[model samples]
Target: MGRVAGKKVFITGGAQGLGACFGHMLADEGAKVALTDINGEGAKKTAAAINEKHPGAAIAIAHDVTKKDQWESALGEAAEAMGGISVLINNAGIGTAGSIETESYENWRLTHEIDVDSIFIGTQLAMPYLKDNQPGSIINISSVAGLIADGMMLSYNSAKAAVWMMSKSIALHCARSGYDIRCNSVHPVFTRTPIVDPLIALGGGGEEGEKKLVRQIPLKRLGEPEDVGYCILYLASDESRFVTASEFKIDGGITAQ
Candidate 1:
């Protein structure tokens, strides 16, 4: 049951959806988790819920990932609270859709600010702590959109692709520097998270909308949070100690085509 028995994990966007799901899942497997979100109260609630199930294993912090100052403060708080930070989960990101011609420059910039740039900040700030705690892991939540191109998702496509490449660069750097901190990116497709709400709404919402969203997925279903969480658990655990600089796709075989 203790897949990550001694891990001290700091997760961004932990207030709800995939972040909350990963927090609960990792804590269940014996990790002490620090849940940070822009929604301070929501992060507390999620942390409280986890503590209820796995007493004293979770904490909450108010963090705006895009801000350098906030990242420093939050990381310090987490390191102190958890005794040290062994894992960093860059799970906070937004979904954006617009063709290059239709997309505003503002949306493009905002998408990169949140989805791509935050990872850059988090990884840089967390590197010292991660290096201090050797054999650590950094999990960046990229998306299938990052691996595949879509004409309609201009900014999203650009941001996610940046995340994908950045992860590899970080991984290679850590390896060359002789650090035991492994870095990898996860690419999930059409997961049933709030991030996909806009897409669903565009499809008209409800079950019909969800179904329309899954048509491209060979499995014909949306990914459950647990699907990605389990993968993160492995990456966060020592089991994947030798695994780094790679991409893990939880896309139900959509990329197989």
Candidate 2:
């Protein structure tokens, strides 16, 4: 497809699942990818695998998205490796289950830091590069819980919801400033990623818990990683140049009900 042939993309949480899917999807389409994850070895493995498929198309970095110093270092290195930055995918996040009464302030703070603050840090650090690149995009991987609410997912829901709105704010700022940096959030429902494993464990830990989730989804099945990754790919590419300050729901039609 060569959708983003010359684009340079920096993705957090790029070692696996939707992150790895984004790498494979974009590399296959001819984009240069910098895959960053907390698990540095895993990131290296994922990047190596991508290079095997599309020689010289990828590099892996050991990045902790929450740290400002690491964000600066990662973007600097990624820019050097790929020539410049054209896109940022703030895909690193975690889910925590707890009602307001049960969730500790510690967990709340951590969830917001990982899921929400990292986006802010990454975007702020990457803005200069993105502005220079022009016609770039930022895809924040939020969740359907961001769009709605869940009794058991208070921390995760709040964090993702913050991301959802934060994306819009950044989009508006870029537009007003003529930065050509479109921003949008993707809301996926129960994608079969490791992120959902805790939920599975909380609900009987097997196909049964997953089935319960699928039952709520009209599509009657869990989403695949690519389902969200390609949607992100579109937002990352110029195809979405006219689309910003919006949310894409890869929720298997769940929100329709």
Q: Identify the candidate with maximal TM-score.
A: 1
Query: For candidate 2, what is the TM-score?
Result: 0.98
Q: Which ten residues in a row have the lowest lDDT in candidate 2?
A: 196-205
How many clashing pairs does model 2 include? 0
lDDT tens digits by residue: candidate 2, 1-257: 68888999999999988999999999998899999999999999999999999999999999999899999999999999999999999999888889988999999999999999999989999999998898899999999999889898999999999999999999999999988899999999999889888777766789988887788898899999988878977888888889999999999899888
TM-score of each candidate? 0.98, 0.98
lDDT of 1 by residue, 153-241 (tens): 99998898899999999999999999999999999998888888988998999998998889989999999999999999999999999
Q: Residue 202: error of model 2 in Å? A: 2.8
**Top candidate when judged by lDDT against the true structure:** 1
Residue-pair clashes per candidate, as listed?
0, 0
Model 1 weakest lDDT span, ten residues long: 92-101
lDDT of each: 0.94, 0.92
